[model samples]
Target: MTIDTTKKIESLIITDQEICTLAMDVIESIRQDFNNVYYKFLGGELKVLWSNQNKFNAKASSSGDLKSPPDHSVTLYYATAIRIYRDGEDLYDFVSSRLNKYSDLFEKLNLGEPSCLFKDLEKEHFVKNFFFSGLTYLFGHEIGHLVQEHSYIRRFFCDSDRNLNASGEASEIEEIEEIEASASSKQLTRRQSLIWHVTELAADHEAITWCLFELVRQAQEEESIKFSQDDWHRLKENTLIFSCAASCVHFRFNGVKAVYPDEFPIGTHPHPMLRIEKNVFQIISGLEFFSTALGINSSKAEISKYINKGVISANIFWIEKYFDKNDLDSGLLMLGGVINNENTKKYMGLIVNEWEIIRECVESIKRYKPFNAGNQDLGLMFFDENFKKEFTK
Candidate 1:
């Protein structure tokens, strides 16, 4: 609902072909980046499902003497929607209503501010927005579940109804298990429930990264007259961008604050000041401004100034407990080196070094306990590493 003068509505809208093309390109990149276990861990099997302006409609028909129910899959439903029917009418009805409500919200919100989920389907980037910004990001969350291996551990912790959904409505123990495996990998263990929250965060971070890419790409083609003119700055501030990925990031940031009171007394996720100070804002800002690989003439001095003034957004307690300070500090330094550029790709070599350091940091963090390969922790590690590497280097 906020107004943004920076974006042109036309620039934000991509044609159906453009959307599919970009989405497929993104997906292909993902496939290349992830393979086998990593792919499975990252919810790879789900792939990218594209929908045209052809609205999903449920129809009733009689195949034989008996009338068949609606074809739910074709309808606007989650990948989890199929199980709703078996759980009984209540569950089915509940999901149906929820989906409809969200659909309505999508319409009402008109998140056409490029990369927002509510972008109209008739537009081009809508599919890309849904896939890269919305779905892929969320799928990464599901990958978090896999990383936790919730299912394997579920046997030891779960009660008798291992098949039951969280609502305890139906006996989809296997279906639920498979869905969990396909999306989140496995059900969460009692001790690992919090991991689910992290997965959501991880997904958010991934989604944000991709969204940044999309936003940057969109900005470059602005002069072409093919894109929508939705104000990018306004869109950035709308908060809906975080509704999925950022939402999880916020949740875990809060939870980690509560649970690890001593270690993360302030919080797990970076605080607003720190987040901005650390150029999380600028990274996003950079992503917002640098719409093309050709690069844009933008000022990052304002961003650098902010980060330099803030308290170091690092918690030594947790860093010592879960990460080696030497590695962690080195990682940050490497990232800073890359993102430190004034505007041009001046720090390309440093960016490459940042990537190496970040990779090591990520592997180290994943090997640690509590987070022991949990979703958000790894996500945080990756986010810190990649952004720092890409931007500054």
Candidate 2:
């Protein structure tokens, strides 16, 4: 069914409490699995809220008295979720239409009907999984920023400018300075820009790690589900696809591109395409890392083959076709030359090293029995209180 694109986004005021609930559940599950003391730092403080902003975006920030421990806040704009859903639905329709057109060719070639390949595209299960995984990646990345103390680090570096008050929003002058820093022709020094880029990569790594872990945990916990080896492979492939979709949504909505250093300096976040490439690489590297770490005897070569054939090839084709048909500026496709295989391999090595550093820090924290996951429910009760009602009007 075609989604109505003509409706004013502000009038579509629905909030998916389920998405917020699932995000909390996923974070709780990860905390349960680790049971490390460090995880508790964010347990009570991290909150997810819905905002009625007309734009497609989300922001993570800290709140509470500066003297006391601050609470980390994540606001998922309603318009952002609507945009993601609409785009995803459109992509599904496009895929389904293409499959129908190719069904006759497939039959002549003795390749089963193309419809069977995407039978689940329109199903509720697929829609839920797609949004679940995508939202998890987005929310989890923000949580990563908090848990990694990026804000605290930023405060330390820009202490004079970032004196936090009780409300947690930046001071007016600080906000202006931030805007100026981002928009200025005089970019942050290379060292400062690299720090920002590394922090972003670190957050991406954490997001991918947690999302993959949660997906596997959920699959294993399913009482009625029996997954064979092939099923596990398919599950991993789907996780990657949803993760890519999440990145693409952010890239498209935010108008992120790979700006050449000569043309424009780096910003607080790495180029959007760089972020996508890293996420794709991290999934593969993470699979390899976890498989070996868990003694699963899974071959990296086999996983790479699966990714190349199943996820990477299919997504590239579909995304390119989608952008071409819509006439959207194709930053994603143009990123190929910038993030080629050699660069990806080098970045993979860097991620492994960075992960090792992060792992050591996490391991240093004493382990504890799992916290009461039920306590997280208290954080979800403020959704209505926190919703940005002004935009809806």
Candidate 3:
């Protein structure tokens, strides 16, 4: 949890091809969608691979500069990929072992017995499918960074002498926007930090939506696995569950104080729990994004169950895996405190407001007609009528 990733120490690096191959397989599984939906959309070749770095981290970077075409790379460190895979399995085993006590919870969420669900396939399918979704998210997240073309690449082309304000002509300090105001250094520093936070969240939104729809595309098109109506529903449920479980695993690595910057200069990425919890809304919108083409027809009530129970699943695994605690009630209580904290609410508002402010910037440049991650430009606010109803009804 405390290893410095700045420098690569051969003593700590794990270049095991097998460990890296699991992530590769996930990319391979979704390659069809990846290429079809993102090839030209991404601007250049997007290379995703495993890193030998020993840290529990992943990063998106590029090599070319202003003179040359940029090629983006998203590398998942071996330590990060391996831990996420293992932690995901551990979380599932922990919950499955306690199914007796949580039978009501499982039944309410339509969670099928792992053994039964995978009986037609390999026993490990339960772990692989859900964990693969988690892995898919990690890869997609890096790609999400590339899709945004945020400050990282802004220096090359965004030569405007003005902030990309969403509405007003006011000056702002954010993402290489060229600070034009006489704002104090502290205010600029603080606002820059906030912009970085919003930048990370925007990528998270893109990645999570990419992840859900990719999962939808994968599940719908899978020819190897035939599912009955009930089994199809269960598959959808677990896909949603492990997506959150993956967030818990990430939180386990990043620590829980990530709710807000005041919690301690939370860096580019927000805490995984806050990222996980609020993204249920994103998942809802994402399903709607792909529902028409994919024929995803879950009701408002069923979608509600997925989000409610997903929170329960994430809280349990987060506490058990991170705090080394097992009391479900206590875990839920702790989660409530984290979510309801005034600072967290404030941080949430910051992202929402910043999102609106920068909406024009992203939409103007983003090439649209997603197969359907950000299906369209204004798809920023909502995916469709169904997405609107999920919240309204």
Candidate 4:
């Protein structure tokens, strides 16, 4: 199992010398992967860039090719790269002990006692995979924003609001004033906030698609690695859950919280748990779709056995970072009480409903195609009309 750490191809310009060499390598891997992914799904290309602003942030928007059939930029800031590197080193081989049911599956993740390598190199590889997968989640999220054309839609409505507010109707100027209105930014109205939540969740939905695909690539990187299709299916399900769980923990580390939040997140972002559950739904739904298409048998319970592992691992990392070992019991008990529940299902419905509400805006203005279809998109889950219909029904 040799990794070509020195392997290089044309990728993002590395301006952040503060980012560790290993971390940059991971970013390069992602850049190469995205080159194929974007073309396959979006029928377009993107320019990847690195920004060293010393902030743990990333963004997507129109690039210099903002002409017809424009290309976009997905920039990863230095602070975020540094954090990804450090977290990979810090959380290699981290998961809850409550996963004996699929212990073998995890071992495939290089998560067990090192049989060959001394001093925990297997665990190191496991964390490296985790970090890279988490990073794919982040990078794919920004791509989600681009593919979905969220910024264009936002600007359209924002401009429309400005015009409407200027030409006040029915003496609404004073009323709009008292309502704490501001067409200048995102603080204009409740509906604006709701739109924010919906778009962010949609971006997350797109992110998981890329994240799962990248995991599959990483698993098969070694020529000797193989699995029975059944074993491989379970591996995809379990590892995607764990990888996304790690990313969600990282999300929480970035100040996103929602251990037991309201049915709807009160901010622009969905609750961290809600986002995690949404990701799980994508995994199970995707597996179900694959099973149906491939004529295989996969049960909900079978595919779901490893669901709690991510929560357990998240609790361990969160408690250790934010609390202490003493709170581990309570944290594990409390961290994931809402996942896979009826409440989450209903809340997910709301997200779909909101997306469908803006589906026309997305369809009318999207700059690219994705496994293109008129009514459904398996590649970008939430964009599929049929899935939205059945899902919300």
| Predicted model with the maximum lDDT | 4
Query: How many clashes show up per model?
Result: 35, 0, 0, 0
Candidate order by decreasing TM-score: 3, 4, 2, 1
The TM-score of candidate 2 is 0.61
Better of 2 and 3 by TM-score: 3
Which regions of candidate 4 deviate over 4 angstroms? 1-19, 23-45, 63-67, 93-121, 157-188, 217-246, 253-258, 263-265, 291-298, 323-336, 339-350, 372-375, 381-393
Over the stretch 35-131, how does candidate 4's per-residue lDDT look in tens digits? 6755445555666777767666666655322244546667776676667655655544344233344345345443442222113244444444555
The residue pairs that clash in candidate 3, if any, are none
The stretch of ten residues in a row with the least summed lDDT in candidate 2 is 377-386
True-vs-predicted CA distance for residue 228, candidate 4, Å: 2.9
What number of backbone clashes does candidate 1 have, counting pairs of residues 3 or more apart or in separate chains? 35
Candidate 3 deviates by what RMSD?
9.3
C-alpha lDDT (0 to 100) for residue 202 of candidate 1: 38
Off by over 4 Å in 2: 1-44, 63-70, 99-122, 157-191, 221-234, 256-265, 289-298, 309-337, 341-393
Question: What are the per-residue Cα lDDT tens digits for candidate 2 across 1-393?
Answer: 011111222322235654444444544544343333443553444455666656655566664234445455666665655555555555555545654564554454344555454454434444445555565566666666655555544444432454442233545211111111123343455444444555566666666666665555543424535544554655564664565465555455334223322222254555555566556666666677656655456787766644433233234434555434332233333334335444443443443444444444432331221212343211110113222231121
Candidate 3, residues 1-393, lDDT tens digits: the string is 001112222332233455466566656555445555565554545566666766666656654242344465666676766766566566566655653565554564465432232234322544455446566666655555555656443322334444432122333322221111111133323555566666656666676665554454444434535434554464465555556655655565455332232433243345655666556666755555444444456665566555556556656656654453544443232334444565665665565665566766666655433533344542243324543333223
Deviation in angstroms for 149 in model 1?
7.2
Scored by TM-score, the top model is: 3
Per-residue lDDT for 381 in model 3?
Answer: 35
